[model samples]
Target: MKNLLLIFFIITLIACNQSVNKISLDIRVDGMSCSHSCAPFIKRKLIKTEGVLEAEVSYEKKLAEIVFNSSAISKEEIVKKIESIADGIYKASIIKASTKETNLKKPSSLNNRESLDFNLTKPGISHSSGFQLPNLFSLLNSILK
Candidate 1:
């Protein structure tokens, strides 16, 4: 019985595997004076946002580079998420955002779907939040100062 279940699970993982489409966002954020203090705050928020796969913020450049699923989230929505943080204190302006579908060939056989390169996550935040992350700009300001 265990062997049968394991085989079924393995087959399910194999059947569901497919190429992914990715979108990249480059945003220039205003009202940030320091990178170390502000960028982390921005990154923490973006990573928590729905549809965001990976996000990097550079305070020195006042820019945010985010990778996400365009089909699931739009550029406008991403900007809204950014601005929503700190009660609209951070002004986010888009420099450019583009998307492309990846067309890599599927491997002849996948022994383990878990071993494949995957940074995917479900879109949106859960009610529990899983962990607490700081989103305070005033305290950050005081610490930086």
Candidate 2:
């Protein structure tokens, strides 16, 4: 019985480790109007990133299908790099994963109003409470006075 259980555990571990991972990413980017001209650059950059074994780009669909080692890389990293290259160019969908898990959604910015659901009191700003710095002329006048 113990031997059978051990065998099952080993099999499970192997399955998890060797599982295939593929991510479907939509790259809505500028400066890439033509696939013939830009496909190679996209492919090269993606391939350089960790765990990416293959990157296939479709010009018509503007989609990038990437096969990678999930243990080494993540969907978020890919999206971040794509966005960094040419602002707002990455939308990732995890078609498959070796671990069968999803990553937590992180806020894009600290001041994202839409995602702010925390309870907080609203404070009013007063005109008199605003910044008031004495001018150089005023300083001179005060000294003269």
Candidate 3:
């Protein structure tokens, strides 16, 4: 029974690590008229997409930053998804793409009236809140030992 429990914990930790294929993509969006409706509209659609973990759209900068699991979806598919919104009113192009080892912290719920503030500019800055999966795994490993 003890051996079985140890194996289960190891498997769980491996599975958690393998599932996170987080990719951060910066996209340039065209044809947004205002920050009020256009930005939120695009943000809502992007967040609803499968494999999309987070999306931040700014009409003032005409930029959309999205974080998703590449294993579940491709960047090209995301760009196409954007272009297909609102009867093709928006055009999207990838500005930059980078792979992230961990997920970024974001609000659990966003108000329609509130705007997202992007503060993830500095390198090596993590805004993760609460206990993360990796930390849990580490604790389990220590306990098992």
- Candidates in order, TM-scores: namely 0.56, 0.42, 0.62
| Model 3 TM-score (2 dp) | 0.62
Instruction: Kindly state the number of residue pairs that clash in model 1.
Output: 0
Against the true structure, candidate 2 has what lDDT? 0.50
Off by over 4 Å in 1: 1-19, 100-145
Q: Write the per-residue lDDT of candidate 2 for residues 50-115, one digit (tens) a residue.
A: 556556655666666665555556777776766565455544444443433223222222122221
Ranking by TM-score: 3, 1, 2
Best by TM-score: 3
Model 3 C-alpha RMSD vs. true structure (Å) is 9.4
Question: Cα lDDT of model 3 overall?
Answer: 0.75
Summarize candidate 1's per-residue lDDT along 1-145 as a digit string, tens digits: 9999896566555434523347877899997867667777777777767556667777888888887757457889999888888888899989987775222223312111222234234567323322232223433355569
| Predicted structure with the largest lDDT when compared to the true one | 3
For model 3, state the Cα shift of residue 68 in Å: 0.4
Candidate 3 residues lying further than 4 Å off, grouped into runs, are 1-18, 101-108, 111-145
lDDT to native, each model: 0.65, 0.50, 0.75
Residue 129 shift from truth in candidate 2, angstroms: 67
Clashes of each: 0, 0, 0
Model with the higher lDDT, candidate 1 or 3: 3
Q: How well does candidate 2 score on lDDT at residue 72? A: 55
Task: Flag the better candidate by lDDT, 2 or 3.
Answer: 3
The list of candidate 2 runs beyond 4 A from truth reads: 1-31, 86-145
